[model samples]
Target: MADLIFYTNPQSRGQTVRWMLEEVGAPYDTEILGYGTSMKEEPYLSVNPMGKVPAIRHKGKVVTEVAAICCYLADAFPEARLAPPTSDRADYYRWIFFTSGPIEAAFSNKAAGWEPTPERQRMFGYGNYDLAINTLEKALTGREYIAADHFTAADLFVGANVNFMLAFNLLEPREVFVDYARRMTDRDAYRRAQEIDGRLIAEMQAQQAPQPA
Candidate 1:
């Protein structure tokens, strides 16, 4: 039996865990879900009531949420050194959740064309889209990665987020984000995950084939 089972569809937040699983080097089985399919089914929904992607089952325990799955996988396989020890746990947990919380909120707002005014931005807590980008830019300005000058799980979450941001042009291709994306994507594990996801996407497209218009 594999040590872990990962449930995700390549199209969703599951891409984040797919990158993480590569980082942790854990042996896992994947049951890809199709739209309006197994994702809302009884068994899968039981695993994640929210019906989210990147859910993991390990040692008979169910774990959902993207950041939690990434953190858990890193901790489970200490050999990967994807996270810092308890000594640096403060920074570690802080940014992982930060990326998931404020970053996501701001991104969602932007995607929905809900740009916040200065006061609204402050109330929103992500410090507006520009500040959010600036905050991340400042962090990556000279640092190769997030955390205490080492590549850790925090970087995986934060870095991948920047990449996603750039994908939608939510973030300008500034030097900092670009450099960070370059650094993050250069990782072998990330490259592997990209390859797998690419192939899976291609197969998905192939399955659709062509139809008369």
Candidate 2:
């Protein structure tokens, strides 16, 4: 078995980690789990009690959460150059966590039709969907990369969100966001990861389709 094991569902946020893994050029094994089934039962739960997809077990250590997995892989495979040097990781840590926290929270809340009132904005880290998205747009305005001059794992996480949000109409099609997402996803690694997941999704959908009696 490969030292790196990736547990994921193709339709889930696991796609982001899949891109990161391809960028790292590591030989990892993928375990496709279904929602509310294997993902919520047995040994998978032990790996991540949250019963989430996109968990990675590297060597012996297990890392869950999408952003965390991306960061871990970058550090674990320095040769991939997916992370800036430890001393030069100010923006790296900044943007990655920002996306993981406030941005994600804002998007999720917005999708669920629950935007906080202006008076209660202070109580929420993201304030509101517009506030969070505008911040991200400004950060990427003139930058080709989120964390450094070159691509990093931060881009993978942030870009995946941007791409997904834009695709689903969850985010407005702002010029800056569109340009940044294009640059981040215009990579061989990203394409390969998407193809893998796309095929998996198709297979899963076919299996779930009602049979023609």
Candidate 3:
């Protein structure tokens, strides 16, 4: 048996995990689930009550959520050097959760056209899209990686979000975002994951298309 069992959908946040998996170079089996059917039914549900993609079962333990999965995998595969050293983990953890929380909320709110008032913005983790964007840009400015001048699982999540946001127009096109996207997407592992997921998405779309008359 492979050390890990990855349950994901190519069209979902699973793309992030796929890149991390490749970066870690761990042995894992991927089970692609379809929307509304396999993903919402049992077996998969037992793995994640939320019925979310990008869940992993490793050593009979289940880990769900993209950031959690990336952090877990990095720790699981110590030799991969995907996690920062113990003493240097502040930036690693900081950026990972920052991407997952504030950045995610900011972009999502913008995409949904849900702008919050200044008073209410205080309650929101991101404050607003501009604040979130500026914070992230400042972090990435003049840096190749988010933490410790090297690539870690934190970079994987940040890179994935930037690439996804820019591609879908979910975020504005800032020089920081564009440069970071170019640098992150240029990785061999990221490219490999994209090709695999792109092919899978294409296959799914082809199957869903109507048959020729």
Candidate 4:
């Protein structure tokens, strides 16, 4: 058996893991779980009780969640330089957690239709959706990318989040957003993952589309 076991559905955030796997050039086995099927069943839940896709069993350890998986894969395959060295741990920690935390917060709030009034904005850690997005916009504005000043798992995390944000219209399509996503998605590995899942998501949509009566 291979040392790596990937549990994923092509339709979910597992697609990001698929891209990272491609970026790092890791060889592994994949189990494509169907929707509403075995994902919640015994063996599957053993790996991730929440039954979320993109969990990985690697080198006799199990890791769940996208950020954790990205961190793990980056560290596990150091040669890939997907993440920074331990010396850069502080910034690395900040960047990854920012992706999972504040970015998610801004998008989730907007998606919920809970636009914050000035009073409400003070309580929002991200300081309103556009501000949260603008922070990144400024970060990507003058630089080629985020922390490390080179492409790393940090970009993968933040880049994917930005893509999610734009896709949902949670973030306005600023020049920064467009240029950054274009840079990140232009990677061959990223494109390959997109190609694979684009087809799968399309198929799923087709099947679910209302039929002509």
Candidate 5:
């Protein structure tokens, strides 16, 4: 068995971690779990009691949450250069946490048809969707990558969120966002990850389809 074991469902946010794994270029085993079955049942639940997809167990250590998993994998396999040097990780930590926190909260709330009122904005970290998105747009306005001059684990997390939001119409298709997502996802690793998940999704659908009598 590989030292790294990935637990995921192709239709979930697990796709982001899958891309990160491909980028890290490490051999890992995958365990696919269904929505409310194995994902919530034994063994898998022990890995992540939240019953969430996209968790990873590396050398007996378990890491959940998409951003943390990506960060862990990058640092665990430094030869992949997925993280900037520790001395130069200001933006790296900044953007990754920002995306996972504010960006995530803002979009998720917006998707659920709940936006904080102006008077209650102070109670929310992102303030509002426009505010959060505009800040993100500026971060990527003139840069090809988010943290370092080159692609890092931050880009994988941030880019994956951006691409997902845009795909679901949760985010606007601004030129900057469109261009940045294109650049981040253009890598061979990203393509390979998508192909793998795409195939898995197809197979799952095939199984769920009813057979004609």
Candidate 6:
């Protein structure tokens, strides 16, 4: 049995977890679920009640949410050196939660066409899209990594989110965000994960193509 069990779809946020898994070099078994089908059904739902992708089972424990899984894996596999020391975790936790919650919420709300008014923004966890984007840009500007000078799980989460947002036009294409994402995606682990998942995505697309009569 592998040390980890990863459930995801290549098209989902599971891509981020894939990169983190490669970085950790942890032996993992992947169960790729399809959208509008197996993902909303049993078995997979048992592992993640929310029916979300990027959930993992390690050492008889289950973890969901991309950021949570990334952090958990880094700690569970200390040999990966993907986590900063406990003493220097302020930025680590800061960026992870920031991206996971506020940034995520801001972009999601924007995409859904639900712009928050002043009062709504005040009550919002992300405050507003501009604020969230500006905050992230400031945090990443002139810095190679979010947590320490060294790369950590925090970078994986933040970097992946930035990359996706920029590519999908979810976030504005500022130079700071673009440069940071470029640096993070340049990592060997990130490339390896992309290559593997890219292949899987292609395979899934092929399978779903219309069959000739």
Candidate 3 lDDT over residue span 12-31, tens digit each: 99999999999998778999
The C-alpha stretches of model 4 lying farther than 4 A from their native spots are 115-124, 199-213
RMSD (Å) of each candidate, 1 decimal: 1.9, 0.9, 1.1, 2.8, 0.7, 1.0
The digit string of per-residue lDDT tens for model 4 on 35-95 reads 7778988788888888779799999899998999999999999999898778877767786
Candidate 6 colliding pairs: none
Which candidate should be chosen as best, given TM-score against the real structure?
A: 5
Instruction: Write out the backbone clash pairs for model 3.
Output: none
lDDT of each: 0.84, 0.93, 0.91, 0.83, 0.95, 0.91
Q: Candidate 5 residues 79-175, lDDT tens each?
A: 9999999999999999999999999999999999999999999999999999999999999998978899899999989999999999999999999
Candidate closer to the true structure by TM-score (higher is better), 5 or 6: 5
Which 10-residue window of candidate 4 scores lowest in summed lDDT?
130-139
| Model 6 global lDDT (CA atoms, 0 to 1) | 0.91
Which one is best on lDDT?
A: 5
The TM-scores, one per candidate, come to 0.92, 0.97, 0.96, 0.86, 0.98, 0.97
For candidate 6, write residues 118-156 as lDDT tens digits.
877778898888999999888988887888988899988
Show where candidate 1 strays beyond 4 Å.
117-123, 211-213
Candidates ranked, most accurate by TM-score first: 5, 2, 6, 3, 1, 4
- In candidate 4, the residue pairs with backbone N, CA or C atoms under 3 Å apart (3 or more residues apart, or in different chains) clash, namely none
Give, for candidate 1, the lowest lDDT window spanning 10 residues.
Answer: 131-140
Q: What's the candidate order when arranged by decreasing lDDT?
A: 5, 2, 6, 3, 1, 4
Off by over 4 Å in 2: none
Better of 1 and 4 by TM-score: 1
